[model samples]
Target: MQFTSEVIIATYNKPDYLRLCLKSIAEQSQRPTSICLADDGSDARIDPVIEAFREAHPDLPLRRSWHEDQGFRKSVALNRAIAGSTCDYLVFLDDDVILHPEALARHFSCATRGRYLTGSLIRLDADLTGRLLEAQSYGWAEGRLAGWTPKGRSQWLKSMPFPSGVMALFDRLSPVAPNFQGACASVWRDDVLRVNGFEGNMSYGGLDKEIGVRLRNAGIRGRHVRYTAPAYHLDHGRSYADQKVKSANRAYILALRKSGETRAVNGIAELDAV
Candidate 1:
């Protein structure tokens, strides 16, 4: 099935990056039915940036919403955005990232049942060193990775880089595998709602990993879109990136472990909020 819409859920305090992010979407080979950006309440300047994009792309369906800048609970804001969209598939991305013209098309092609698709994020150290891209420019595009790339070299151009076969093998063996990452992922709306949408309680990080585990527990298998669909990550020094290693975020994983509930791939729960 070809979905006419793709939702790119993003949140950031930086206005400049948000502007470029919107522009990149406008350039997609297959334009989204609607581009919705959920801002986790940012500085006053952020509003104008969003407004400017909206004005320039008046013909393109775009929606924007915000929550008061309270604690940096990305999960809650993400849920808010997801609940607001009616797209057949949702694509979550970071604010500073840029997509290749065919990024959306590649993800659409990789859609498969019981498979939660994952894509690599190419990071360029120099471009992101100063927070936002120096000139709203994308670095380079990487098809895939043999292993996880650090924050710096995620976007370096590479031809046919392989993925970590060990990681793939381990995922196939483990009951719960790591498959979810925001850089580039495509999931059905029903599958996402089945897990209650990102565990709004997770304060800073680990929400994506925990959700992937929950999906696995729910019987959905992991799928990697490596070498097929690639994206570029503009480097920024956000604390959330480093928070993956923080012990506090690990608590979110423990919460999932305690649930003992598995989501079956063949079914979906009706979300009243959705």
Candidate 2:
């Protein structure tokens, strides 16, 4: 079955990274129906970046949903994007993650009903990320093995194209369970609506995992797409990541998971009811 997909990118004030992200999206082999930029709270600088991208790719549907930059309210911004989207499937990306040309196509091919796909990103070191951003060009393939080295069980799958049979075999036998990394993952729109979207109260840290747990509790399974849909992740400082807040959020998510709570109290439902 063919599924319509939309890419929803959550951003703050990273215009350079966002520009690269959009450029990667523009190069997708199987482009999304639309791109919804979920701006948490950014200044006016992001406007020209989006405008330039729109002018460059007029055929690609792009929409921006912005709110005041009160704090790191990523969940609220994502909730707004989810509420605004009109597609069968939703791919969530971070501002610093640049996709491979085949990333979206692979994700769509691996997509199954009642399940979400969690992919991985190869981290690009500070120097490489800076050079690429400064050059305003994305040579993802050339820099595939630039900063880090891939090891472990699935190391052979890095930056290699496999036949359809191999992809199917890997998708079936892969031992990795679905752990939602907001940087690269895809889920169905109905499933997200079923859980009322993400919890707005969450700050960071286990925020994505909370929704993954809830989705599993609601009977949706997690599919691992680590090598199949790998992307390039631009490295940056995490100055805004508050350890205390993340700890509290993780504890709250654990409590909710233990209680088997599926729907978030202040998620998409609350926003829609308003």
Candidate 3:
């Protein structure tokens, strides 16, 4: 049976990256039911880009849920998208990550009812990222053939042929860990709501893992899909990453883990209450 899923691309003001991301999604073999742009207070420049994308992909249902430019409130923007989405499943992606054509298909095939899937991305160098952004074609082969380096573990799985059964075996044997990466991940909407969504207080760094910790505390397991549903992450300087804020967020998450905290203080409930 097929499940209804939506792709939520959390983005700021990078229209160049967003354009490539949207194009990749549009080229997916197993397209999502809809695509939602979870804009975290970007400027007016993003308006025409999104409109053009929507107009070009007339068959794809594209919508935006935006908030005022109130700093890096990605957690809040994602919560807004979750609240607005009508799909049963959600595939989360950052604007800079360009997915493989089979990325969604792989995710859908591996999706489990009671668990969330955490995937990985190969980081593309600045030079390649620039070339891809300039080119209109969403050809992932160009990057792969050009030898983009995989950033994390299990990236070698990208080259493996489908139906290898390695992913299933890995999921069964792997231990549940708090490595929730928001770059390329998919989860059931109900499961996310159960943990009250991501902590709104988090600044950067450990925010994604914080949600994973809460999910684990709530008895929701995370399946490692790192190699199975891989994407290419564009390399760019992180202007929002503050080391002090990241350290604080990490400390908060560690404390929650030790205390066995299952729900976030500022999360979906607060959003719903508003």
Candidate 4:
């Protein structure tokens, strides 16, 4: 069965990465049902980058959701997209991650009804990221990673996005718990609403994990599709990640775990209440 999907690209002020990110989407073997630019109040600079993507790939369905520059309200922006998206499945991507040609195809295939699929990211050092961002016509980094040096052989292996034919070989148990990673994860729209969507009252850290744990509480288990749907995460400074807020978020999530809370207190439903 073919499931309809929408790709939600969460972005702030990074226009260069956004440009390449969109390019990677454009190169997908299977195009999404639609694409939503989940803009968290970026400046006017990002408009041109978005416009260029639209003009270049006019056939792809695209739209944008924006709120004022109110610090790190990514959860709020994502919730807005989740509320607005018209698709059976939602694939979340960060602005800095570039996709494999078959990434979307893999996600669509792996999206089952009972569970959300979580994919991993191969972190690129800043030097390598800079090199690729500067290089033109190279957003799809599948076979080109041969000469590039990642941390080790294990890390380098992740850069290779295995084609669909060999997927069954790696269907063994996942090493890590299937957690919801923001960069590359897919879930049913119904499941998200069932848990009231992402917690709007959150900071940069632990927000994604909070929703993941909630989904588990709500009986939506997670599946690791890390190897099959792998993507390259670009390295960047985390000036926005405040340590105080990070600690607070960790405490909040721990409370949720202890209480086994499901729905988000300040989520999509709360947004409608105001």
Candidate 5:
């Protein structure tokens, strides 16, 4: 069945990364119904890139929401996008990841009722990321690796594509926990509304997984498409990443896990009122 899907990208002042990310979206085998960019207080430069992209793809529906230059409020940015998105399905992506041609196709193929689909990203080295930023769309397919390109746990595994039959078998037999990764995840819009959307109080770490915890509590199982829906994560220094905030967020998520919380206090519904 063909579901109307919207791609929500969280971006903050990274124009180059956003440019590459937008290019990949334009090249997707299956175009998303719309593109919603949740801009977390980006500068004037980012607007030109957005305008250029809009001019380049006049047919693609693109909308962006922006707030003032506050601290890291990525969850808020995402929630605002959630409030505005009108679609049957929503795909979340960080502006730093470049996707393969089949990434959206793989994601949509895995869409099922009562479940949100999660996929993985192959982290690129600084050198490779630079190379990717310099390369054109025709040259970007190399990011999908045959083996672990950067040598991290399951990076190579996630980057590799498998036959549909083989992947279905492995996904069913796997004993590992299925986690929601924000960089590459898709869900029914109504299911997201059921959970009240992403935790707006979160900072950086485990923000996406926190939503997964709530979704599970709300009885929405996760479908893992890590192997089939591969995207390349561009490596960059996290100026916004705070270990303290991350630890706090992680602890909060664990507490939510114990409490079996199913809805976010400061999420889409709440933000919509403000």
Candidate 6:
């Protein structure tokens, strides 16, 4: 069965970043059925920003909604957007990232018989240069390979083999994989709803980790699109970095593991529960 997914771009106060993100989405080789802008209660600035874009691209399938400031619980904002939409698949992205030209087409093309499909991100500096390349150029981190493309750069990727012991260790560490960024991923609409959207408690950190865990618990296999359909993350000040915030994220993960509650977040049910 073939289906088209609506790309959801979640934004907050960063109007400049929002414009860039939307521009990238606008130039996609295969445009999404619609672009849903889910704002996490921002100041009046966002309205003008969105309106400007809307005026520029009158035919663009752009939708907008805003909610009150909900602390660090971005999951709540995401769920709110999901509940407000009607699409076969959901493509999730952060506001500070730019998609490759074929991002949406590749994601939907490969989303078969799985609950989730995750792509890798190339972490670029604020200036949009390759960090690894910079390290090699400055003779900081010695490199064995001349030009190694990190996972999720494009559709073509090379395979490398490691020892069985190392592979076993890697499998054990699946729950805490370092590259579990949900910014460049997609999920079946039904599968996401079945899992009850995201855990409302995990607002700031660990929200991505917790949602990934739940998907795994529900027997949803994750397909990594490393070196394929890569998105670029625009680096900025890590405002979400705080000791207290990380602790709260860790506690939430522990609770998710202990409770073992796995269910879909249906839109109607979400409204009724709230």
- The model with the greatest TM-score is 4
Write model 1 residue lDDT over 124-227, tens digit each, in one string: 56535344445554444364322335443323322224453433343244443346887677788778877767766555566677778888888876676544
Q: In model 2, which regions exceed 4 Å deviation?
A: 140-156, 161-168, 272-274
Instruction: Give the distance in Å from residue 147's predicted Cα in candidate 4 to where it truly belongs.
Output: 5.2
Model 3 agreement with the true structure over 14-113: per-residue lDDT tens digits: 9888988998899888999999999999999888888998899999999999988888899999999998999999999999988877778978987888
Please write out the lDDT profile of model 6 over residues 1-274, one tens digit for every residue. Answer: 6676788887888776777678777777888888887777888886776887788878777887567885555777778888888888889999877676666776777677555877666665544334422341211112112233344513122111233244334333445343345688888877877778776755566677778777777777676554446576666676766778779878867776687767534332565565
lDDT: which candidate is best? Answer: 5
TM-score of each candidate? 0.77, 0.92, 0.91, 0.93, 0.92, 0.76
* Backbone collisions counted per model: 8, 0, 0, 0, 1, 17
User: Global lDDT of each model?
Assistant: 0.65, 0.84, 0.82, 0.84, 0.85, 0.66
TM-score winner, 2 or 3: 2
Q: List the residue pairs that clash in candidate 2.
A: none
Between candidates 1 and 5, the one scoring higher on lDDT is 5
Residue 101 in model 5: lDDT: 79
Tens-place lDDT per residue, model 5, 87-185, is: 899999999988877889988888899999888777878877676666533253354532225576466556654565676666666577788899989
Instruction: TM-score winner between 4 and 5, please give it.
Output: 4
Minimal lDDT window, size 10, model 4: 139-148
What TM-score does candidate 2 get on C-alpha atoms?
A: 0.92
Clashes of 5: 1
What overall lDDT, based on C-alpha atoms, would model 6 receive against the true structure? 0.66
Q: Mind giving the per-residue lDDT tens digits that candidate 2 earns over 1-274?
A: 8778899999989999999999999998889989999999889888899999999999998999888888778988999999999899999999999887888998888778889989766777788888888977866434243444555435546454565456556766767666887889999999999999999988868888889999998989888777667687898998879999988987897788789889988898787553
- Which residue ranges in model 3 land beyond 4 Å of their true spot? 142-155, 158-178, 272-274
